[model samples]
Target: MAEQAYTVVSDSETTGEEKTSSSFPEIAIGIDIGTSQCSVAVWSGSQVELVRNTRNRKLMKSYVTFKDEVPAGGVSDELAHEYDMLSGAAIFNMKRLIGRVDTDPVVHASKSLPFLVETLNIGVRPFIAALVNNMWRSTTPEEVLAIFLVELRAMAEVKLKRPVRNVVLTVPVSFSRFQLTRIERACAMAGLHVLRLMPEPTAVALLYAQQQQQSGHENMGSGSEKIALIFNMGAGYCDVAITATAGGVSQIKALAGSTVGGEDLLQNLMHHLLPNMDDLFSSHGIEEIKRMGLLRVATQNAIHLLSFDESVPIDVDLGNGTKLSKVLTRTELEEVNKEVFEKCEALIKRCLQAAKLEAEDVHDVIIVGGCSYVPKVRNIVMSICKRQELYSGMNPLEAAVRGAALEGAVASGISDPFGNLDLLTIQATPLSIGIQADGGDFVPVIHQNTTTPVRKEQIFTTVHDDQAEALILVYEGDEKAAEHNHLLGYFKIRGIPPAQKGVPEISVCMDIDASNVLRVFAGVIVHGTQRAPMPFMEVRMPTVDDGHGWSAQALHKMYGSTLDLVTVKKIQHRDC
Candidate 1:
C-alpha cells in the first residue's frame, strides 16, 4: 500500500506510549448521545443489541446532578422527583449548549431553563452554574457532558465485562467543526476513545441499508437502488437527510437541519399556558426553582398527553398563591408550535431540492426520534412526502443507537459469512468547508454534500508584495461572505521567501479522513526552487470558540489585507 499521507491519533489516547497486546479489544460500542437522553449498544455476536443500564433502562436521561461533590448521572442515581432534576442541581441540554457562544440566541433561550446561564454576548464562553448547597458552582458545558459520558462508560464496562475504551457517537447534522471538537474534548475528558462520530440520520440510513440488503435477496428488485428520506426530530435538534442505497453501500444525497425540537415545543406550550412564566420563576431561590420545575413537568406531561388524546387539562399552583388552570387541545398545541412544524417541513423541502429529486421519487420515508411518536409530527412528514404510511420496520426510539452499533462492528473490521454485519455508509459533508480569501469572500474548497474521506486543494497568492504570511480562516457554511458563515478556526502560514505580489504559490489543502477528523495543510513554492517535500504547517480545525462571529469581524477590521490571499489560476482537476 502507498504510504499514508497523515498519522491518526485517537484524541483520548495521547500518553506517548504504545501498549502491545496479543489480541485487540472488542469493537467499540455505539452510543447515541442525545439532548434529553442517551443509549449505548454493541454487536452482541449475533446482532446489534442495546445495553441496559444498572436500572435496567435502555434509555437514560441525559442529565448530570452536581449536588454531591461527586456528580451523579441520571442513569444510576434516580432523582426523588422531577423537581429534583430542575432544583438548580442538575444540568441537562448540554448537547444544545455545547460550543455555543454567549451571543447565540439558543444560549439566550437556555437561560430560561432551570440551570443558570449567564451571557455577555461579546464572543466569549457563556457562564453556566448549577446550584449546590445553595451556592452557585460554575461549570462548563464540556464538563457536564464529560460527567455524563463517564457514567455511560462505566455502565458499559460493567455490563460488557471488559474495559470499554472506544465508542462511535451519533451527532446532529448541523454541528459545526468547532462543535465537533467540543464533542471530542468531552469524550477525551471521559477517557473514551472516539472511533467515529456518525451523523444521526446517516446512522439510521446504515440500519436501513442493512435491512434493504437482506430483503433484496428474496425480492425481484434485489439489485435495484432504493431512495429514502429520513426525518429525525428529538429533544434538542431536527434533521432531515436523503440517501440512496444499493447492495451494501449507502450514499447520502442531501442533508438539512435546525436547532428546533421537543424542547422548543415544551417551552412554547409553557409560555402559552402561562404568559410571562419565565419572569415568574426568574429567581433562583429554592421555592422558585421548585415551582419552575413543577411547571416544566406539567408542561412535558401535557405535551405527551396531547400526543395520545385530543385535549389535556393542566392545573398547577405557582407556589406564590397563583393558581393557573387551563385545558389545551391538540390543535392548540399544534398552533403553539406552528413555527417548529413549518421549519421541519422547510427542512424536508430543502433536502429534496438539494438532492435534485421530487417527493414522488422517495421510495421510503423513515421517521426516528423521541418526538416521532407525536401524531402531528408524523402527519406533517407524511403529508410532505405524500406517502400513505411510514417505513415501520425500525423502532423510532432505538434505531439510531442500533445503527451506531452496527457501524462500530463494521468499522472495527468485523465480518460474518451470513452478511449480518456487511454494511458501509458513504457519509457526505453536511456543510461547505472553505477558507476566507479574495478580501474576505467565502471560497469553498469542498461543497456541501460531498462524500467524506475527501481532500481538496486550492492555490492562492499573496495580496501584497513580499508578504511572508497568510491567514487561513476556515469556515463551514454556504454564505457568500465569510463573516456570515460559522468560523471553524484560523491559522497563519509563515516561512515564505520574500517575493513579489502573486509570485509565490501557496497551496492550501483540506483533508477529512474516514473518522471525520479534519486537518489543514499549507505549503509554498517558488518558480526557481523545487516544491517543499512536506507541508509548512498542519493544524487540526475548529480551534475557534464561542463568539467566533465577533472574532471574524475583528480580524478583518484589524488586518485589512495585511496578511490576506487571493485565488490564483487553477490547474485542471476532476470534479469533487
Candidate 2:
C-alpha cells in the first residue's frame, strides 16, 4: 500500500462549512444486556465493531447497589479494560429485572442472591437487590437499571462523540407486555429511544444472514432456499427460531425462548459451591475470586468442562485450610441438571411444532448466544433435530449484539435491510380466523400454526331489533373457551337505524399487516362502511431482590419485562 500525495484541489466553490455526509456519524449500536455479561457493537459502515465494556469488565453482574460509593466511582473516559474490584457496592444481572412484575417465577428464584434484598413483598421474596441504601432511600430497579444504561450510553457517546439515542433492544420471546413496558421505561430513563423490540433468535438470524448475503455468498446452502435455524443459548435465556432467507431476508417462522439460560446452569453450579465453599460474598472474598480471575474464568471453564468431558474439577475457596476442590463428571452435571435439559428439549419441540416442520426440514442450524458453547446442549440438539450438520465456533457471546448492530445500521439507512430481513413469523392463529361464541365457547375461524400476513372475515346479524350498532370480541390462543384465550381487543360498528334483531348486516374482518400488527375491522350498512383498529407486541424480565415476605410461587414468574407495543405507533423499550 503506497501513500498517495494529496494535492488539495482548492476550488473556490468549496466554502467554509462544508456539509458532507462524512461529517455526520452513521454508527448504530446494539446492546445485548445479558444476565451474565453486557455487550454492544457499533456498525461503522464496513462491519460491526464489537467491544466489551472495560468499566463493567464483564457483561453485567445483575446486582444493584443502593447509595454505594463503589458503583458510582472512577470510570475513566478512556476505554481501559480494568475489572472493577469495587466491593461494598452492588451491581449485577440487571437484565433479569428489566421488565418484571411482582409475580414472575424468576423473581422468586432470585431470593438466594446472597445480597441483602429489599422492596415490597408482592409474593416475590427479593423485591429488589440493593447493596447500599441511603438512610431514607432505597433504589428502585429502574434506578438500578439507570446505572447500566448510563454505562452503555457512555460507551456509545465516547465512541460517537455525539449523543447516541436510538436503539433496537432484543428480549426473550416469553416476555409479556407489562414486562416490556418496564424495560422500555428503563431505556427512556436512560435517554435511549427503542426503535424496535426484537427477539433474541431473530437478531441472530439477521446478523448471520446479513453477513452471508453481504459477502455475495447469499445462497450458500442447498434446496436453493435461504433459511436458518437460529439456536441462541445464553447466560439467562435460550431462543430458537426458524428464519427464512431471501437474499438474506430473514423472517421468524416460529420462536421459542426460556428463562433457563447458561447462567442459570452456572448458578446451579454456584449452589453446589455453596455446600463446598463458604467464602462467597465476604468482604474481600468475592473480590479475591475476581482478582484471581477465578470467578469469571473458572465459571466459564467449569461450564465448558461439565459440557464436555465426563466431569471436571469444582474449586471452592473455603478459608483457613478447608480447600474444597473436586472433579465433577459430566454425568454428574447431567444428573443434576436433568430437568433443565428436559425443559429445554420440550421448549424446542414446541417451537418445531409451531413451525409445522420436522427437524429434517431445517436448512441450516446455527448456534449463537453465550450458552451454546456447551457441547452437550449442542449434541442433544443435533440428535433431536436429527441433523448431521451444525455451525458453531463464532463469537457466540456477542453474535446477537453484532447482528443487532447490523439491524440498527439498516434502520439508519447506512445499509439496506433488504429484507436482509430478520424475519419473525408473527404467532397468529387460524388461517381463516374467527372469534368465539358469547357462551364461553370457542369459534374457530383460523387455527394456530397458520402462516400469517393473512386476511379473514365473518358475517354476523344484529342481535336486537332497531339495532344500529354491534360489537364483536377479538381473541388469540388455543383454548376451547373464549374467556380462556387472550382478548386481542374488540371491534365495534356504529351507524345503522334501529331495526329488528338480526336485521343489520354486520361483518367483521381481521388482518395481519406487514409489520405484524393485527387489524380488526367492523362494518354496517351506512352507505356500506367498515372501520377497525390495529393489533399488538416484545422483551425483558425484572426481579425483586429484597427479602420481602412475598413468595415466588404465588406470582409464578409473571414478571412484565416484555410487552405488546405493536398496536401503539410510538414504540419504545422504556427502562430497558
Candidate 3:
C-alpha cells in the first residue's frame, strides 16, 4: 500500500481552542488499556494497523516502574526478569484499582500484590505506593495510569510520525459513569483528549458488523440480522455482550461484567502451590519482595504452559534460602480456579437471558482477550454455548484495539472509499439512572437497556407544603433503594412558589449524548402555566466527590426530608 497522507482540520465551534496549521494530519488512535497488557492502533488510511513500541512489539506490559526519581512505564524500558517486575518498584493493574474507593473489595484484594496499597475502608481513595531506593513512595492510580498513557502516546507519535492527541479508548462495560470520569481525568493528565470511550465488547461488535457488511448480499433488511455473543476476558476483568448486527449497524442487546480475571487465578494458584505463601512472603523487605516476584513468575509460567501441556514443572529458589519445587497438573489448576471459570459461564448465561435469546439463537460465539487462549476457558465457554468452534477470523489479541481505531477514524470525521469506516454501533445504557424519590426510593427516569443518545424525564413534587426547593439526587443502578445504588450526582432546584404538598410540578430530565456524557436538567412549572416558574438548571452528572458514599449519607442526615421529592402524575406536557 502507498503511504497515505491526511489533512489536519480544527473545528473552532467544538472545543473553542485555536488550532494551528501542522505539517502532518492529526489522527486519533485507538487504545486498548488492558488490565495486564496495553496496545495502540490507528487507521492507516487503507486498514487498521497496530503501532509498535520502541522494542518493535505491539502489546506492552501495563506497568510503570518508579526505580528512579522520575517514573517510567514498562513500554520503553524492559525489565530484566520477572523478579524485577515484582521488585517493589513496578506498579501494575492500575486498571482494576482506578476509580475504586478504599472500601471496595477490589482495592482490598490489590493489597496482596507486591506494591503497597493502604486502605482505611472509609470511602476515600486508597494510598498506592511503590518501593523505590529502600523507601515507599506514595502515588495515586490516576498518576500511574497517566504515566503509562504518556508512554503509549509517545510510542504512537514516534511510529506514526505525527503529533497524536485525540484517542478512542476501550473500557469495561461494567464501569460506572463516575468511573468513566476518572478514566477521562487520567487521559487529560496524560495530555490527551478522549474522543470516545467505547465499551470493549461493543468495539468487537463493531468489527463483527463491518466484517458482515463486507461479506453480505447487496440487499439490506431485517432478514440479514445476525446475533453474536462476544465474550471478553482479560487479566483483570471479564465482560460479555450480546449484539444484533445487520447491514453494518450493530445494536447491543445486553452486557454483563465483573472484576474476576487472570489476577484472581494467579493468586489462587500461588496459594495452592505453596499453601503458606502469604505467611512466607508477608514482609516487605527486599528479599521477601524478591521471593514473591519469583513465585509469581513461576506461577504465571505454569498457567501459560498448562494451556498447551497436561502438566508443568515449577522450580524456583528464593533468595532467603527457600527452595520451592512442585508439579502442577491441568486438572489441579482448573480445580484451584473453578470459581473464575464459573463466573465466566454465569456472565454469558446472564447476558443471553437479559437479551431474551438462547445459545442456539447466537450465530457466532466470538472470544477475544488475553485469557481467551486458555484451554479450560475456551472449553467451558464452548460447552455452555453449545458451539463446536470459536470465531477465528479476527486476532484475539488485536481485535479490540483495531475496532477502536476504526471508531477513531469514523468519529474523527474521516471518510474511506472502501466503506470500512461506514459502520455504527447502537449502544445501550448499561444501568438504570434515576433520582431519589418517594422517601428514599430509586425512581428511574432512564431504565437499563434503553438506547443511547437518549433523553428521558420523570415528574416529581415537593413532599412538604410551602416547599421552595427540591433535591435531584441522581443514581445509577437497578436497586429499589436509592442508597443501594451508585450515586452519580445531585443538584437542587429552588424558587418554587409556595404551594400545598404535591401541588407544584417539577420535572427532572436526564440526557445522554452520543459520547455518553450525561447532563441533568431540573425545573418547576405551575399547574396552569406552560413555562417553568423557575429557570431550569442544567448540571453535568457525577458531580459528587470521589468519596461519594459518605456524601449521600451526610446530605440525608444533615437535612432529613427538608428538600425531598415525591413522584407525581404528569399533568402538563412540555418538551424536554
Task: Go through the candidates in order and give each one's C-alpha lDDT.
Answer: 0.85, 0.55, 0.85
Q: Write the per-residue lDDT of candidate 1 for residues 240-287, one digit (tens) a residue.
A: 999999887789999888899999999998889888877877776777
Better of 1 and 2 by TM-score: 1
TM-score of 2: 0.68
What is the C-alpha lDDT profile of model 3 across 384-433, one tens digit per residue? 89989998889998999998998888888887787877788899988889
Steric clashes per prediction: 1, 85, 0
Flag regions of model 1 displaced more than 4 Å: 1-24, 79-81, 218-222, 465-468, 495-505, 528-535, 545-550, 568-576
lDDT-best of 1 and 2? 1
The total of clashing pairs for model 2 equals: 85
For model 2, the stretches where C-alpha displacement exceeds 4 angstroms are 1-27, 52-64, 69-88, 116-126, 133-137, 215-223, 270-301, 315-325, 416-576
In model 2, the Cα lDDT at residue 51 comes to 50
lDDT of 1: 0.85
Task: Give the per-residue lDDT digits (tens) of candidate 2, residues 435-528.
Answer: 5443344454445535566676565555446655444545554567654443444434556556666555555566665434456665653333
Sort by lDDT, best first. Answer: 1, 3, 2
